[model samples]
Target: MGNVILRYINLMVVTLLILSFFSFSLAYLFPGHPIENLTGIRLENISQIENTEFNYSSGESLLVQYWHYMGSLFDGNWGVSFNSGLPLYDEITNVLPASIELSAYALFISIFVGIPLGFLAAMKHHKLTDYSLLSISVLGYSIPVFWLALLVILIFSLQLGWFPLSGRISLYYEIPDITGFIMLDIFLSDIDNKEAAINNVIRHSILPTFSIALVTTTLIIRITRRSVIETMNTEFIHAAYARGLSGRQVLVQHGIRNALMPIFPLLAMQFTTLLTNAMIVETIFSWPGIGNWLIQAIYHQDYPAIRAGMLAVSALVVIFTMSIDLTIRLMDPKRRRLKRAAI
Candidate 1:
């Protein structure tokens, strides 16, 4: 077990370094002197990342320059944006919670709603219910996220007037920044009206959330339908039925438990994809998030912010996926046996 965990940690470190290097290398894709041109800030400003100045002396190789760049980026010594001239890290951290809050809500909706819909479809196999869901999933799989987001905005935000078109919350709700997450902040605030503030957050969230959730939910539905069907056919499920267990008990107690295990890693991987879609969704809706910040950095060609954003987002996804792998290993009975064998 310890060895498995150690190996996973070691791999995560290697992946993070590789990802950081890849982000660092993006500077070299263009003209000369990558660091000086890309950072846009004085070298001395970035030097305190390690409290050691990096001249990137003429004699030094590209690798050495990368080391200094990586150190600065990883440690938040990314200096400032070329356009806004704000510390790159502070800017990113400020908007990160918005992205996280949106992503969390999207994922939560997909999992809770998708799993049940999937099982319902599976149980109704060959019926209209199953075909309808499968058809919807197929459509979801095909539609581009950006287009779908736009369409939803057109309908919900514009035509029907059910939700706001953009922004995290209405300008009027001066929610305190207690947790950085607007919904929570609204609750933490001593505002004149808490419900209205939260209502604004939810209203703004609905369209974007629906856009993100549609694709993920469709995927979950497909996977869960397959997994649950396979679980239902297994001999153990038959034995449970023979032992007089109800359909609900068999599914809720035994079927779902085994069926869900295989999908845990898949869910983690999907989360990375979710973040990727979030970048586009954030930009489309003008939602304040790391994605929107990154998009602005790209538009203005703020290389420091771009580099920092890439590294930050890559690290976030890699770390999350690796952590999920470790958790899955810890929980899996088959993996436990493998660990014992290795021991």
Candidate 2:
């Protein structure tokens, strides 16, 4: 187990170095000087921008600049935003929580809703329930996230008034930032209307969460149904059924568990997909998250912000993928057997 973990850690280190090289190369690989490109200013005198620490000059070679960049990473300096003059790392800290909160809710909805629906669809096979779930999944998959968000906003927020149209919380409640997560912040803050704070957060979160969740849930349903169906037809499942296992027991202990093994890798990929989709969802809903922040940075051509955001997002995906791979390897007996045989 320790050896496996060590190997994965080594792999992650190599992957991060490669990612850093490519991401840091943005400074030189891009057409103009980083500062000129970022700020849209043409300075004839190098001395004008030379004194400033943020500006990239023609004097420094890419290797030296990359060495400095890598050193800064170790020193916890993730560069500064050209547009805002704020530390890129600090900006990431501010918006990351919202993304995490939104993603968590979306994943929750996908798992709790999708898995059971898929299970039922697989169990019913050729029945009405199977056909209905397939149709719904197709519809959900086909709907663009932004459109779905707007549609829900029109119905739930504009017409029904059940949820807020946008934002993370209502201005009516003054919630302080404790953990950066609004729900946790509500609990920690000394707000007069705690109930109002919680309610407001929930109301504001529903539309965007549901919008992203619907798309992700559709994917989960299809994957789960396919996996379950495959497991159902296996000879091991039939053997288990013949061993006096009831339908529920066979499904729960054997079928779903076996089906779920394949789903782990899919879930990891879905997590990154959710992050990308989250940027769009965040933009539509005007949610204060990394996605929205990155979009603005791009529009303004903030090189530091762009580099930092890409690096952070890439690191997240890589770390998550590694964790999921390790977990699956540990849990799956077949992998363990293969590992032992190879050793």
Candidate 3:
């Protein structure tokens, strides 16, 4: 166990370093200096822009600029946004929490609901339950995210009047910003009237969360169902059945455990998918998250912000993939032995 963990840690560190280097290189690959593109005021006087005292330069050697850029990255100085003229870190930090919150909610919904439905579908096989679940899964998977989000808004917000159409809360309410997550903020705030905050947060979150969760849940269900079916047909499962174990006992004890071994890796891959979905959902709901911020940054051609956003997302993808690989190794001891031998 210790060796496995150590190996994963090493892999994670190496992957992060490689990704960071790639991000830096990609940022520099874009035509023209990011600063020049951002400022719009080119420095005709090379000497003035190159002054060591002011630390403002356009004529510095490429090597020097590269080193300075790398150094700034280490110091968390991602430069100013050309479009907003605001510090990149400030913009990222402000929007990231909202994205995280949306992702967390969607993830929770996916796991809790998707896994169970999948398990049931697998147990039922070609029965009515299975066919019904498969049909719903097909619909959930096929629906386009933007269209689904709009349909949800129409039904729940416009037609039914059950939820808010957009934004995190009612404009009239004085919401105390604690964690930037509307739900958490409501819980943390010492507002005299708790009802208003609770109601407002729930009303705002339902549509977006449901939209994002529907797609992810469908995916998880499919993965879970496939894994469970495969596991149920294995030799070990047949042996358990032959040993006079009840169907329920055999499934719960032997089947689900083995099924989860494969399902875990698929779950890890879902992290990246969830993040991507969160971005789309955030935009639809006008939720304040990193995804929506990234869309805006791209539109305005804010290179610094774009670089930061892409780096963050790519880093997340790498981490999640590595994590899934490590999890598979941990769950399947044979894989770990093979990995160790290969190493």
Candidate 4:
């Protein structure tokens, strides 16, 4: 166990380092002068550009600039955002909670709906239920996120008037500053006014959450169905049935566990993909999240914000991947043994 933990930590560190390097390289590749754009103080003379103290001045070498950037990162200075006139960290903190909340809700929907549906489909293989689920899964995967989000808005918000069209909360409600997560803050706030706060959060979250959930649900169902079907056909599954195990016992104890093992890794990758996909949804809904912030930063050539956002997203991906790997290693004896030997 100790060896496995150490190996996991080492892998996480290496993955984070690689992601950091990649982010830095990508940021460096961003066209235009970041410092000038951020400061809004342009130098007409090339000599002035060279003489500026704020510019990369450790040395005129590329290696020196790379080291300087890394050093700045270590010092907790991610740079300044041109658009908001705030530090990159502050801007990220302001928007990150919303994105995290949206993603978490979407993932919850995916896991809850997808797993049971997939299990049913697998159990009823070659029957009407399976076919119907497979068709829905295919359609779900086929539709683009932005289009789906729009369609959802049209139906739920405009047509039925069942949910709010955009934003994280209603403008009328005054929420006390707490955790920044609306749902959590609502629950944590004064109990007498909780109903209004809860209603405000649910009302605002319904549409965007549904839109994101739909996309994730489709992906999860497909992966889960495939994994379950494959697990069902394994020799051990048949052996379990031969041993007079109850259908429910075999399905839950053996089948679902094995099926879900493979799904965990995909979940991590999907999370990162979801972050990128959320950009269009956030824009359409006018949600104050990192996705919309990133789009605006790109449009305005706000290099600092863009770089910071990209790095933050990359870091999240790396962290999620490392977590998934460690989880798999801990759960799977074979993986744990391999990791131990490698260590």
Q: Highest lDDT: give the candidate number.
A: 2
Evaluate residue 341 in candidate 4 and report its C-alpha lDDT on the 0 to 100 scale: 51
Every candidate's CA RMSD: 3.9, 2.6, 2.9, 2.6
**Which is superior by lDDT, 1 or 3?**
1
**Candidate 2 per-residue lDDT over residues 1-343, each given as its tens digit:** 7787778888899999999998877866667876565445676775767754344433577777778778888777887788888888888988988997898889888989998898999999989999999999999999998898889989988899888778888667777777789899878888788887788788788889999999889999999999999999999999998999998999888887899888877887788878888889998899999999999998987887888888988988899888888888888877655553352
Output the number of the TM-score-best candidate. Answer: 2
1-343 in candidate 3: lDDT tens per residue? 7898887798788877777677666555776764455344465676645553145333477566656766877788887877788888777777887887877888898999999999999999999999999999999999988899999998888999988889877888887766676777767888887797788777788788888889889989989999999999999999999999999999889988789887877777787878898899888889888889999988887777778888777776787678777777877976677656553
**Could you give candidate 4's per-residue lDDT for residues 1-343 as a string of tens digits?**
7777777788778877777777667654765564464355586787777666346542356577667777888777888877777888878877888898888878888889988898888889899999999999889888888988899899988999998889888777777767778788777877577887688787887778777877788888888888998998999999999999998999878987888888887877778767766767898899988999999998888877887788887787778777877777688876666734563
lDDT for every model? 0.82, 0.84, 0.80, 0.80
Q: Which window of 10 residues has the lowest lDDT sum in candidate 3?
A: 50-59
Q: lDDT, candidate 4, residue 41?
A: 58
Q: How big is the positional error of residue 71 in model 4, measured in Å on the Cα after superposition?
A: 2.7
- Winner by TM-score between candidate 3 and candidate 2: 2
Candidate 1 lDDT by residue in tens digits, 265-341: 78888888788888889999999999998988888878878878888888888888889878997899776557435
Clashing pairs in 2: none
lDDT: worst 10-residue window of model 4 = 53-62
TM-score, ranked from best to worst: 2, 4, 1, 3
